[model samples]
Target: MLTLQRRQLVGHDILLARHGNHISTMRVDRQAGRVVAYLDDGSVDSAPNLITPGLPMPATVRSVLREDWKFFAVATACTTGFAGVMVAAAVALAGLSGEPGMTQLLSAYSGT
Candidate 1:
């Protein structure tokens, strides 16, 4: 007969089981809400939940970037630059508008 053991930790859960001569391990990350299973046959399976917004990357992307992480570095740099530009634009627009634009538009509409 095979037996299964389970352990619950603060931020994760682990399961261990044996079938015949093979042992399987499973881990669940509570924060990420993801599950990974390592089968006795040397196979790995993962299930990721959508606690965060954004589309999941395809398997092909992982395969292509497996050896080269410079792509990710460049991507991060581009994202940071884009965010900075957006913030600057917002600040400039706020400064340009201030209270004068609103007061002028209201006075014109009210005929005062």
Candidate 2:
């Protein structure tokens, strides 16, 4: 970013020539809702411009997934271990057999 002379600054709608006569793009001012750029005489311009690069799904989601993947794996592992332990305990301690069903237990606990 080139900083032109402050004397050359103008109003909020100060024009900036990116290439030729036409104003290609305008940069917004940070402090106010004005613009920042160069005018015909050359100066710093500013405005309240918002540029959206669009949603980067993979880039953004990757960070969130990376941060949560460990917890997800741990949760899944714990759930699997809990289910295994429950089945084992039922079979061994309770001497339960015949499909070792959990429908009744699951249904009763689900309500509670």
- Which candidate leads the pack in TM-score? 1
lDDT of 1 at 53: 40
lDDT of 1 at 19: 35
Q: Which stretches of candidate 1 lie over 4 Å from their true place?
A: 1-66, 100-112
TM-score of 1: 0.32
Return the lDDT, model 2, position 15: 48
User: Alpha-carbon error at 82 in model 2, in Å?
Assistant: 0.5
Kindly list the per-residue Cα lDDT of model 2 for residues 61-98, writing each as its tens digit: 45656878999899999999999998777556444433
Runs in model 2 deviating more than 4 A are 1-62, 94-112
Give the per-residue lDDT digits (tens) of candidate 1, residues 1-112. 3233332232222223223234376677657666666778897755553433474333444455674688788999999999899767666665677687754543343436
| Predicted candidate 2, C-alpha RMSD | 14.0
Best by lDDT: 1
lDDT (0 to 1) per candidate: 0.55, 0.51
